[model samples]
Each structure stands twice: as C-alpha cells, then as structure tokens.
Target chain A: MADIVTTANLQEPDAFYADLVAAHDGLSKDESDAYNARLILLMANQIGDHVILKKLLQEAQRTSRKA
Target chain B: MTKLFEAPLYPYKRCADQGAGKPVRHPVIVIGAGPVGLAMAIDLAQADIPVVVLDDNEKVSTGSRAICFSKRTLEILDRLGCGDEMVRKGVVWNAGRVFFGDRQVYDFNLLPEEGHKRPAFINLQQYYCELYLVERIRALQVAGKPVELRGGNKVVGLERRDDHTALTVRTMEGDYDLEADWLIACDGAGSPARRMLGLEFQGRVFEDNFLIADVIMKADFPTERWFWFDPPFNRDQSALLHKQPDGVWRIDLQLGWHIDKEEEKKPENVIPRLKQMLGEGVDFDLEWVSVYSFQCCRMEKFRHGRVIFAGDSAHQVSPFGARGANSGFQDVDNLGWKLKLILSGKAPETLIESYDFERERAADENILQSTRSTDFITPKSEISRIFRDAVLDLSEHHAFARPMVNSGRLSVPATYDGSPLNGPDASGLPARTRPGSPPVDAPINGTWLLDAMGHDFMLLGLGIEVPPLTELLGLPVKGITLSGEEIGPDLRTRYLGEAGEAVYLIRPDQHVAARWRKLDWTEITGALSVALGREGEI
Candidate 1:
C-alpha cells in the first residue's frame, strides 16, 4: 500500500500549490485558502484509516499554529 | 400557463422566464444534456419528481469521446428504457489484447458472468448514448412528466439560498434567474458551475503531451489495443493504437518533452511518423490530429449547499484505462437513486451527502490508480524509468510479470468500505465472501436464487426476517430468500459466508449498504435512516 502511494504520489504539495497559484492568477486569498483546505481534505480521505488521519490532522494543526 | 415546447426550447426558456418572475420550482436541477446528466434526470423523473436539465450546447456532440460502456452502466441505462438502444448500436467487445512493440504480450477475455444479462463492455460513441437519452427524455416529456433541456443556454452565475438555489443563465437573446430546490453540476472538467461555486480542483498536471489522431486506416492491425514502449521510428517515445468502428483508428503519439507543438500540427510532419510505425506500403489517410494534456484532479467538495458535482467536475483522470468517463457514469448511477429517494421525501436530505462521500472516494481511488498507471507506462524520473524498463524486461520471461503489465488495478470495481452508509460485517468469514462485496447467488425455492431484475435495492435474508425493509422506510425493496440446497459454492463464498445467517441490503449501485446476521430492527432502521436520510413508519 505504501508502495502504491510512494510510486504515484503527486509532486510536493507546496510545489503543486505554487504552480496552481501561478496558472490561475487573479484568484483571491480566500479562494487560495479554500483550495488548500480542499487539497488537504482529499489527501486525508485517501489515507482511509481514521486514526492515522486524526493524528496527521492534529500534527498539521499544531504545526500551523506554531508557524 | 404555457406548456413546455410552446416556447422555443421550452423548459429552459420557461425556466428562464420563471427565474425572472417567481414560479414553482423543482427539488433538483441537473446541468448538462450529456448521458450522465440525462441518466440522473431520467431516474428522478421516473420516480415522479420534476427535474430541470440545462445544456449550453444546442445539439448533441457527434462521434465518440467514450466508446466503451461497461455492463454495470448498461444495467442502469436499461432501467431508464434506453438500454436496448445502447446494446443495439454498440459493438460488443469480449476480448482484448495488449501488445508490446508489435508482439502480443497478454490477452484478456471478458466473458459474461453467469446470470449477468450483458457482456463486460460495449463500444458505442458518447453521442449515440446522449441521443438515446434525449429521445427518452422527449418521450417522458410527451407523457406529461417533462425533463427540461435548456439548449443554447449557459449558467452564468450560481447563488445558494437558505432552502434553494438561484441560478443566473444566459440564453441566445436574454438572461434570467432560475430557482431550484437543489442543483447538480455534470459539467465537464472545465466546469464553470464548479468555478462559480468557488471549489478548488486539486491534482497534478503531467508535462508530457500526446498527439491524438483520428484517422481512416487500411492497415491490418487486429482488433486489439497496441502500446509500443519505444517504437523504432520515434525512439524513446510511446505510441498507442486502438481500433474503432468504421475503419477509424485512434492513435496517440508521445512527442517527447521538447518538441514544438506548432510543427507537429502540420500533416506533413505527422505522416512520416505514421508511415514509419506502420512500415512500408501501409495505406491510410490522416483525418484529424490534436494535442492533448492529461491532469489528475478532483474538486475539494462534491457538494455545497443544495448544489452537487458529478463526473469530470468531481475528478479528472488520464485516458489510459478509460476511467475518466466511465467513473463519471458511475457517479451518475450512485447519485441517481439516492437523489430520487430524497426528492420523493422518502429519505432525509442528509442521504444526498452520502452520495458525495461514496462517489468522491470512488473518484479518488480511480485517480490514484490511473496516475500510477501513467507513471508505469511513461515514467518521468531516471530511477522510476529504470524500474519500469526492468519490469518490462522481466515481463518476457516471468509469468507473474503478465499481471503487472495488465494493470488489473484499472479494471477492478471500487469497493466502498469506508462509506458512512456501510455497516459492520461481523461474520468472521473469508475475504472473498465478505459483506460490502458484490452479490452472490444462493439456493431458494427448489432453484438457485439470483438478484432481482432492474436497478433497485435488494435485501437478501436467511431464516431471520426483519420488519418489511422497504415498506418501513417508504422506499422500494426487493426481498429474496436465500435458503438450503441451491447455493452455489461461489455465491455462498461471496456473500452468505460473511454472516453465517444474516440480512444483506444492496444499494441500487450494487454496493452493500448494511448487513447483519441477527434481526435488530433498531440497528437496521438506524443504518437505513443514515443511508436513506429520513424515517418513515412501516
């Protein structure tokens, strides 16, 4: 399963986000935030197991708060 | 009050008028006149609910974007009365071959499963599918259950109200506001409806582009799919060829990372590449060629307020496994029955949310699998490319290599284990016959028992009986008894094996919604309420 994820995983989220911002210029900050939120949600859902997802979400939230 | 068609393109024009002035609205509004949207509309309309379908294009697009229809989709279309037409026009393909540089590496035969009414896949253009649907809709309209098709009209803006949705549409001559109880966007990948709703489409965009040429050919390429890793003519480039009806062949040419897109547009530049691949004295004419880029993306949310998204609007996968359109049709199938129940007031509004939950998961799985396939076929990085080549090299001598080369992941039906609607399968059974899996035939009444015909829910029970399942919920249910001698080994192993003795309710989309060995009306009803969204007295 990890092999599947590692083999086909998209480029780094930050890099993809940067490309998205560049291609779709004139997007508002709110739109960008919404887009980021959706990306996170989709990734979490694909991870499937709720326990691991909850931990990941908590870690993300903590890191964001620290930043 | 004027009837539909009394005005030009009746429903759309009338909807535009009603939008301008207050008028009675329907519970759901579906955008796009394509087969997927029309299938949803047909299901809802048959259940005695009014639905408005809007399309910007005046006429159905010609030729086939999706030429292959799976058996599951055919069953859904059959319920809508257009199934026979699809079967009639489509060329049934039972066998497929995969070639490795002119050598047939592997082949697959999709024979009809026992008791299944149709073949595995049918080849029919998307246009014909839409045409059949349009014919059905028109017939329904004449029968006084009208499905509004607003052609030559565009949805300009979308606004959600507290209990409904307000849509601003632009027609040829004017603009008007339309209100609906709910909205569904079946719009294509570049969905303006999704954009207007401000949802984000997230995924990766491949830098590699392929030239898709639809041409008339006389070459003796067998009725099989051919993929060359590195053809002699275009070294280090990939080429794909597939047979279509009427001597038409669809070819895809990988133009490396650095070729000029403009130079490739000339017929002169493309002819040499075709001749080289086909060999000397090959007779064929180039009809059309265009460059296409693939992206693997899906909308963040499949629903917002009273509006929902389906098909390409929800996710976009590569064309490798033909997952893009097939999965979209599956979305239509999944959402159709749930929406019907909700609109009829038999189910709660929350049941509609589960449509998003289930279909989005299916879409994500599809995109993930397809992206993996693209990587395997055309690896990007050096290490990945080396691994791919190594696999291809081993494929010649190893038997296990054949399955890996076949890309079985693309053909598997998506399982919905994590859906909110799925219940616990407590039966400690083998993996094959687990609950939440496909249905199996069992023995009953001196004969083998099979699933009920038509596209509706089925509840299979053994010994234990619960309160009339569908009657309690005010939804249609077909109850079948699975008892004694007739249960086949495969069937017993597939479904009944899970809960030694239990009741299994199958959703219209052929997914297991809830299952239990003992009759616990409270838990059964609770799962039903969650799956259907409302409670009704039996």
Candidate 2:
C-alpha cells in the first residue's frame, strides 16, 4: 500500500495558491464563490475514499478560524 | 440511416472435406461474427494462426447499435490493421455538451492533450465497423492465412474435453462436427455458446429503459455528443443526440420501464417524439428504433478451460458510458497476443489466466462507471433526484463541479495496476505511464508511437540508447531510441518527464510491464519472462 500523503505535503504551496487565486481573476464575487464550491466537489470526488476526505474536511474546518 | 453497407453472406464449406474426409481441426474456433468475433479471428489470423468464425446471421447489425468508439479502442483497432479506414469513415468528435433541462450545465473535451493520432471518440454505425472487419479478414485470406467466416452456420452443441473442445455445428446444407484446441465465445449478450455451457452471469440491472432511434436528416448539428438531463423536449427525462456517419442522427431518450416497447416503437409514437425534439416541419426518415434496458453483469469466470469468453459473452454493461463495445475491443486486444503466444508455445497456459484477471478487472471498472452514470442519469429516490439536480445546478456556474456530472465517463482502456505481470516502477519515475498503464500516443518522426511499437515486447529508451540488441536476443522484443526533441515535449513529459535516461518495457498489448531510470539488463530479462508467463513474477 502507498502512503497516505495529505495536501499538507504539497510542493510549491505558494504557486498553487497563486494559481487558485488566478483562476477567479476575471470572475465576479458570486462567480468566485461558485468556483470555490465546484473546486471542493471536484477535489472530493478525486479523493474518493470517504475516510481521507473526512479527515481533510475536518482539518480545514479546524484551521478555519486562523484564516 | 440508409443501409449504406450491407454484408454479403459467405457460403459455408463442409469441414469434413479439408483432410481426407476427416474433419479438419482448427487451432481456435470463434463463434459469432460480430465486431468481437470478427476482431478475434482477424487478430489470430494476422498472427499466422488459422481461425474459423461461425455466425448464424448473414448480415451486419441492422441498427446503429454500439455507436461510440473510444481512442484506446481505435488504437487497438489500428494494431489490428483496419483502424485508419474506420476513422476515415466515422464522425469524429472530442467535445461533449451536457444540459440540465433547458440550461447548459457543462461542456467537456476529452483530448485536451495534443499530438495524439486519434480523437477522443468516433460515432460510426456498428454495421460499417463489421463490414470493415470483414474486408480486413478477406485481405488476410488473400495473404494465405484465411479467417474462414461461415455464415448461416450455428453451433448447436459444444462439449469440453481434457485436451480440446468438440463443437457440433449446423449449416444450411448439413451438420458437421469439428475439434478445436480452444474456443472463443463472441456470441454476444444472448450468447448461445454461454447458454450451451450453462454459465450464469451475475450483476446489477438498472430498472429504467431507453428508446434509441436513428433518423436520416441533413441536420446542422455539430458532430459532438449532446446529452440532456430533463430535456425540454422530453420533460423530466434525459435525452442524448449524437451524429453518426452518412448524415444519420442517433437520439436516445430515457423511458419508464412500464412503457410498452412495441407501442412506443410505433411510427406514430416515434414521429411525435421526433416532431417535438427536431421540430414538426423538419424532413427526416426513421431508419431504426430500439427499446432496451441494459444490465451490468458478467460470467463469474471468463476462462472455462479450453472455452473462453470475449466481448458481450464475457460481460455486459449499461450503454451509458459507451463501454459495452469499446471494452469488448479491449478484450480482443488483451486476449489476441496472449492466445497467439500460448498457441506458438512461447508462453505457458497460465498466461491465459492473466486475461481472465486483467479483463475481469476491466469489466468491473466498466460496470462501476456505467452503474454510476446510470444512477446519476436516472435518480431512483427523491433524495437521489435532489442530489442530482444540485450537482447539475452547481455545474452551470462552477467549473469544479463539472467533473461530478456523470453522463457517461466515456470508455478508457483498463490498466492492470496490481497484476503479477507488472514490474516495479523506478522510485522517481512519473506515474502516468508506469507499470500496468497503457502508453499514451505520441508522434515519433511523423509515425505514431503505437504504430512504431507494433505488437511485440518493446524496449523504448527516451534520450538514451537502449542496451545492445544482441544482449536481448531470442526474446520477442524490439528496441528503439528517441530523443526528447524528436518527439514533441508532451511525449517527453508522458514518457521521460523527469528528464533522465529512462527505459520502459512495454507488453504486446501496449501496457507498460516495467520501467527504470537506467537500463538494467537483468531486470528487463526477468520482467520479459514474467510478461510471457514463464516463471518468476515481478
């Protein structure tokens, strides 16, 4: 079995963040919100295992106040 | 829609006349001459193995059944030596549009990557595909290795023996018995061979039915696939429209299971639906109409001693994903070289078992995707419908949720990731074209990579020279070297993205058996032996 690498193990985090923001560069506020929702769903589908997805979701929620 | 290509029935010859009044035993007898059976025969005949194909029907399929051919399937067909013609004659498209009611939800393009030879999908009538295959078989006949296709011939009985299987065939003139070292059942969903063997197919069946109609019209619709959930023409139900070759349009509409198939198939009923969809004044002629409910299922074991199953005989899937026939072509591709190797005594009988393993894994994947597509298309419960609509609504404004919208995953070739035949991937190697994965298409000096690879064990070196050919002599392997600049950068990214001296050992079916950053002669030999079903597995 392969290791359970989290998104925290991502390389070039700043580049990914820049790209994420650049994706909604031309969109309106509502469009940007919708885009984020869509991105979350797509990522969840790719990470199909329920256990891993739940852990990621909980981690994001736990760090929500910091952001 | 006009029956453009009609199949000519070949007269059956007496099997007993071949060898001094004794029935001439064939190496392999394939029952049924549809795409699957014909493909099996052609593949075997190309390998210099004599094959006999028997079909009860004299003509190609009457309807535009199994219309969509995937890129992977086209590659396999190319290897079989008849893909270019099919592509020339078929309607090619890579982009697809999905609609939620009257609003367009999302559109997707499958071939975002460039430099590939074939498109994402091609829509051709099943008859034309069969006709092309039959033409190919005839060409093989002229070349001395003839794949004898006997029309108006039926296998009435089959008895499996310790060493071989005996088939009792009935023809128009008389009945004859022939022996075969192996039997392949490509007899389709209602396989008579499967029935004769009393094999039980087990799996899930979607309760909804779909109405498919092929109409001839000079419509201005593009050759892209258009699918709608709760289409305006058919309220609260799904509909699909695809362009086929020869100005034919394939329209599939979801129908309730309780609807009477015969009543719904009537010209009055069908015409009204067409009127609603295509507008009343449009001139069109209905060529064919079919009402069907698909079942996602397969036989427990594809290999039953000397008698094996391929295509619909081995498994069935909902037509949602266009998986039924495309996966069938993959089965032909997977089984062809393995069977040839086994017949030539180059591989063990255990090699055939890998076909059972890899193809069943493919079947399960197809079934899973098709089932999910069916569920999303025809939501069962109120909650299911709510979730479906939510995803559909979200897709209209959001790019991320678009992938969640499952109309049909569209057929992709299966990868045998966990198979014993797969060797370990180099630690820092890119994962896309790793062991068990099929190699992506790229151009190497104007020729397609797959075309250059041929149907043999390939040792491909990217930006590095492969080991001397003499070192790997006697094995069925070919070595080729390519600089990253010779092929496009995409080829380098797909094959040698890490920018190092990389070597890959690819199987006859185009699946990568093993790879390493540097050539290891011992490792290549070991992986090649395992791939041939010789001894130690990687």
Best candidate according to TM-score: 2
The CAPRI classification for model 1 reads as incorrect
Candidate 2, what DockQ? 0.11
Q: In candidate 1, residue A3 scores what lDDT?
A: 18
Error of 1 at B216 (Å): 3.4
All candidates: CA RMSD in angstroms? Answer: 12.2, 6.7
Flag clash pairs in model 1: B19-B177, B348-B533, B348-B534, B433-B494, B443-B487
Please state the error at residue B180 of candidate 2 in Å: 1.2
Per-candidate TM equals: 0.77, 0.87
In terms of DockQ, which candidate is strongest?
Answer: 2
What is candidate 2's CA lDDT for residue B374? Answer: 82
Global CA lDDT computed for model 2 = 0.83
Tens-place lDDT per residue, model 2, B461-534, is: 88778743433435557888886468477687788776566889998899999998887888888888878877
Residue range B1-538, candidate 1, lDDT tens digits? 4321133332344444544456446677898877778887887787677888888876664444666677667766766888788888777655665555556555666566664465566766666688788889888988888577778778898877899888887887777677788898988877888888778887555546677776777767567656677667666667877676667777878775577888887899888888877668878987667776656788777888688888887888776677766787778877888877766666677778777777788887887787787777777776565555555555565544555563324334566666777765655544543444544334445444432534666666764553343554665676665555544565566665644566766677666777777767677666666556553433
Give candidate 2's fnat, 2 decimals: 0.12
All candidates: DockQ: 0.02, 0.11
Looking at model 2 chain B, which ten-residue stretch has the lowest summed lDDT? B467-476
